[model samples]
Target chain A: MQPESLEAPTNRPIYSPVIVNNKSAHHLFICEGYPSREFQIFYSSVDDSKKTLLLVSESDSTIDHDSILVTHSELTAKLTQLLGEMPLSTTIYVLGSEAFIWDVHSVATQAGMVAEQIKMFAPVSGQRRLFCTHCYHITEDVTHSPAVCSGCQRNLLVRDHFSRLHAAYVGVQIDAEDPDDLPLPQELI
Target chain B: MSTDQIKVRVAAVAQVAPMIREFTLTAVTGSLYPFSPGSHVVVEMPGEQKIYRNAYSLLSDSHDASAYRIAVRLQDNSRGGSVFMHQQVKEGDELLISPPANLFIPQWNAQKHILLAAGVGITPFMSYLPEMQRRQADFELHYLFRSKQTGAYQLELAEQLGQRFFSYDSDQAQRCNISELLADRPLGTHIYICGPEGLIKDVQSVAEQLGWPDSVIHFEEFAAPKPGKPFTVELKSTGKTVQVGESESLLEALEEAEVAVPNLCRGGVCGQCATPVAEGEIEHRDNYLSVDEKARQDCVMPCVSRAHSDRLVLDI
Candidate 1:
């Protein structure tokens, strides 16, 4: 039987086309929770006219002559404008918390950009929201090792299975094999 | 278990547009199977050399069993199927067809639905209209065609959809601004489009530009697949090798060699003819497999996909 369940004909399901070492990127748009050493190094080489950076924590504050600090709403609008008419070979670089990176990516894709044309480096990590594959529960922003599913109310061990399409990591029952026993605590994304 | 074949007689034929004829088929038996909207059936018609199986959307109401209706436009480059339906088929002729199967079902979570169609691609959308109206779902149908006279179902659509129907003629050399149509739309707005490949591409490209996720954008392309190079298939179980000609699909070649493969749409759709590949690269000409699946090279839709390598080892 034909089991090639391709949902969209032209659109790829996975987030890819990530910036590679050898590939050339024509335009670059950077979004960050705050400026970092990585940004300083990346900015040192790129021409000012070719890059636009949006820093999201500061309100009505222009931190650097080269960058603008805007809130989340302002960032959304600015990202759309920058991405709408972006020519071919445009690659966007995202840095910040897990939520900030995924949220901006969500917006970028909505505006018709593919993952291959974008890159992400989440530095402000530990913001975890894992969706349970078994119960379909989203354990939102649990900054702990043993996460609990909000829907099914079960102790879950979030796996590294990340679906870029859903922008959420998958969580499975911690006591699947050894029922009534809990595993040792471990760090989670 | 054997798949039962139903016999139906062409009760009526009418020219709905230039070079396009709509045929109504009534079941020879007591009753026909009821189908939901957005469903299609494989029509078996005698062609030049072989039995031509083409999937056609049912234009009649989903609840109707008295008869099933389908429209076929004579393609300039006549495939034996369309050419046969256009020229040889007459009223009162008995024909065989399979029961209906659906691939393009409506989404339940969408706040609104947008249906776009072009040319004879409007057949599937015709089936969606009744169900959408029955569900009382908010929908707008935008249709593009050559002209008022050439566009099938224009007057009927205008009469039925008072203000919801929009039409653009291709003669004016002005096409719908796909970007404008996609921009500034409400959240959770889902769109379904069917038409020529170019228009379909425009819609998908613009939808992506507007940040419309693939979840909200849907399309159905009915164009006959382009012919490809000939290749050989090595069936692992039977130890048989079948030579697939340039014009012959792997599925067709396998059928000719007395190997049975389940297929519904025969179009690179329905995923009914996807066969696993043990070795050799594939010329994946199907829209059914995901990018990951295509990259893995573990499977190929034999209905449309062929082997890029001279010989392919199939799991069968």
Candidate 2:
């Protein structure tokens, strides 16, 4: 099933809410899922605030400030429609790494919008997300060396994310610090 | 006397070809139990100095189990099992034997039986031939070999089955047009095929186009290809996930992940490795499952199957 339309499971894969970083909010890219981030922090690095929304593209070079948008396949249209009428100050970024996304990006670009704003955030090490079987939301920060998911309490080892897409979604975010520190569960957040 | 008293003695050994070897075993218990055609026996061979159990198809006619015939083809890349069976085994040696077990057999009353064999895949069919002749069953045999020279028992099989036998020698680049040949046959005939990955795939795709269902197709594989890449695998029950490299089969990957998947022949022939595929796509490279099973994407052989999706998800 596409990431969209996925409902919160009555029986969650995880029970304990462990430490999570701000970047975990991008799981929102999957849509209909809860966005979990501590607090939206102001810029300390990269683009400084000029009241500008950074339009991250799969390719930074291809990003034309005045051009149409381009991005990954399925999410492009919904994203384009959502952002197409927004002011030019809102910069969009597209994730690149393959053809399917490339086509989506190209189509978005031709639609008379900024194509270069799509950010390409590849999953980084130590910054990982875990699907909570109990909660059915992609969660983060299990404990132990090969950590057991705080959600389901099952041992979470590397490569386990690919078996079933159900709770296997994980992507690394740019700024993740003290991932071990437990935070309030999303139910409370 | 008892099952424990039965013993098999190797009467002769021959390295018929680089990859193929024949073992002639005679039951030393004075008498042997009857084994049906297409039956196989598990033989214990000396491993280093110890014994290891290996299953081999009985090539000798099933009418007499007192004497057994088995053929083993050494995998090009040695895993020590086949290579050792060919290297150390000698004439006049005794090996433990199991009663014949078969996953392939002829339906005695079935009107038509179509047999398709590729190289060493012909071993099981070799046993079926005598039964077909005895019962005067309407059977047709098609043997496919890389070359005429590679065809085993070419003359003998043809002599026994007469005009019903067809040969495809890849060496001479001669192969019968199976699709065209089968087009005229009646609908009730069962089609059995066994061979290499490429050939099996070809036959399956063609059969699908021809609208053949699962009941019509049966097959076995002598070898299986390892998957292409190492990727991530997730276990649902425990919510545990593991990395499976391209070098390892899904079964091996699961084993490493500490997930037990029931399996017998890791070569993708036996259906023991069959498990439910709850999610994700797979690159099927097995001979066991029917086309319908493959289409449903519900079951797969972990021993030799690979994932088509970046990450594969399975129920088991």
Candidate 3:
């Protein structure tokens, strides 16, 4: 019997499809993910064909047969190059996990991109990260069962409540009332 | 010598509008205190009876450190502050004032600045125009007032700002449509509104409905405080409870209890009086906190915010 986590697949793979909008952005930057059908629909809607797409995924395959970069260093270099060359009129769309997207966002903002200029989308992958509400410690890639908060040294069950400001699932004390009735081990977060 | 206090002589006093009066304060000895574009000074007006401390934004050019200019709009029901300034305060009289502090500042990184002002609310925006024109930044000013004769800086704005300035007089039945003003704004455009509570609330709500995020929308609300239900504040360290009257602010109540707290603008525009809440619910009345910060329910500016609960536990 596999252990059970607080959350399981809700028929929709969350970490797969990051963002879904046909706003026709000037630049589309994709990280490692494989919802190729949705990606095709998104990129097709955009009219910018000349140097508008940059795939920073480690995977060999890309959606539109455009530009590709594998390594993190290469991604950084390309981001810097693109941000420097482009004017403030450019609209950027970013797709990746919580941590990965924020990393790209930090770089973009440091390069003088207004928050309004960029749109970030979280993937629908099963990879779940939990953030402790108490000590505010973020536990990354917790796949199975309630985990002890590394921040405040308390056992926490990942709550369904997601904070857009914190960019992670909120985790509260699992054994608040009765310590003996600890949360049962769970999987598939 | 008090480090925070600056001695200044009132250089000139002139009626800028119907209810508005401009007071020019030059330093008594050394040059006037240096301040940013959107800075305000707390004036200590010592009348024959008591001293009334009121904060007024500096309307003069930030580069001009020799003098500081502020406009005071006399309130009919004022608590002796504006009335004293208008009727009693004389030019060449030396006065003590707190050094300038900036709670409202411009977005330097913005591609365009949309400024909305109402009557005397145009004071802060006046400080920004010189810097904006110096940088050649794209900007527009929308001024709303009672009438042409009652609006401050009408002739000066027309002469200096050319077509960049727009005005709407209520007496003339003209209105600055917030929706139309904020519509079709360019990306990276930051909107700043300074005026009455109604203007701030209306413009902000309209901007939000138009899909503008809180980051791009900025406002400074110096809305006068209103009386609320009496409440009790318990000091976390001393366990002392201070009874706040319906007519008194939490800051006033705390002071009456001899619990010292930092304060500048009693109007709640400044964030100096923001104190952390150890426990209990807070009815935030200040414009300092953002919508998300208010939702957090962790901090409250006692200068304006009253207690919704019977008792509030302040970290003080």
Candidate 4:
């Protein structure tokens, strides 16, 4: 499918395995939880001398020697300040849940980072965030279809179509054609 | 005439610089089509012997569709097109021009834009100014020219753009530091260069050394096809031969022979007129093909490319 066409969400991030670009002058790694084995493997592929890590977690546990720890609320402010000073030769790696990674992606893009300059790892959780087309409401932590819109309390059919601007899956009224016809919520694979 | 052709009357003309002549063309019939910034139109100049079709960048405000303005610089080695505009064309004369087509638009999502232009190459950037200003885009213009006598619209640009405009006068030994200009730029900044081949190569090499991604750098080159040795091409299907003249392009030769081949821009930059080669050596001069594609030698862009062999057999 052509991503530029108005057909479907073919432009969704594939989250392919990271291959370190050796030419990049700087490497940045942002993790939501404790660094996973995948993150560690990817981080090791980068040059040891020019890497920086930012961990977003609530625990005050001991962290890596050079890593900075920040709470979820501080991720935006911290990322903005860090990205503002970063040069064009920097590559950013984000590892987190689906919602968490996209949230960081939005912030990084707003701070002048192109899609190519940023890399995202596969999401750790199957949960998603949905945006209702009818009420323009956002529903979080959705793991199944036929999710209810928080704002309008309407049953919506969650579609695979994703919007980078909204950073959410599209949701439309499932029973709009017939009021009596309503499909049961099924777990999304 | 093609449906895409627009009839225009020369509303005004001015010798902006020593070798540069600016012409303001108004619609002869109705309102002309609106065009984006950095768009160009191919003007058909009827010379004494033949029609010389030359592409010139639209330099007027894109929002104003009432008139299209273009600046033509007289080539030192006289090409009939620029010479006709310089010596024969005048106000109130009707001319045929192609509808505007753009290939050098600014990246709208860029955090900043840096434009590098030299001499007559600065024409396209003139239309970009009003649009950029309307959007409140952050941009800087770096212009390199010979001197005040030949720098078209240099003073007007400086006055309109103020500190954002930077000029380099070759006569005064002023040079633009490409390395310094590209260094330490923000992550999403885009750079556009429209200058001599040497200037474009210099900036590209410097930008590559600075680790800038290729996506962020853009350029537009419309090198006029130079006269070459005469050659011949044979159609593989019909076994008919067509002779290509020294002054005419292979695409033009094919058109004259009633062999239609799709084409646009007629400059090597656009890849529309690529034709398959069934046999014989090919001379690839287009910017659209990759190095590997050129090395393969299976195809050629007839608009600007020619034959290195005495005769070529085209798959057409």
Candidate-wise lDDT, in order: 0.75, 0.57, 0.75, 0.85
lDDT order of candidates, top first = 4, 3, 1, 2
- What TM-score does candidate 3 reach? 0.68
Cα displacement (angstroms), candidate 1, residue A177, comes to 25
Please give the DockQ score of every candidate, comma-separated. Answer: 0.05, 0.01, 0.07, 0.50
Q: Which stretches of candidate 2 lie over 4 Å from their true place?
A: A1-189, B1-7, B17-19, B28-33, B42-55, B94-98, B224-262, B273-302, B305-316
Tens-digit lDDT string for candidate 2 (A109-186) = 444332223332222123334554444445543322344455555443323233222324332221135446533322
Per-residue lDDT tens digits of candidate 1, residues B1-120? 026678899999999998678999999978888987788888888776876677888898887767889999787766578889988999999999998888888775455788898888
Q: What TM-score against the true chain A does chain A of each candidate get?
A: 0.68, 0.28, 0.62, 0.87
Give the runs in model 3 whose Cα sits over 4 Å from its true position.
Answer: A1-91, A95-113, A120-189, B1-3, B47-50, B148-150, B230-236, B239-246, B256-258, B277-281, B289-298, B309-313
Best by TM-score: 4
Ranking by TM-score: 4, 3, 1, 2
In candidate 1, stretches whose alpha carbon ends up further than 4 angstroms from where it belongs are A1-189, B148-150
For candidate 1, the per-residue lDDT at A80 reads 72
lDDT of candidate model 3 versus the reference? 0.75
Better of 1 and 3 by DockQ: 3
Evaluated on CA atoms against the true complex, candidate 3 attains a DockQ of 0.07
The top-ranked prediction according to lDDT is: 4
Give the CAPRI rating of model 1: incorrect
TM-score-wise, the better of 2 and 4 is 4
TM-score of model 1 (CA atoms): 0.64
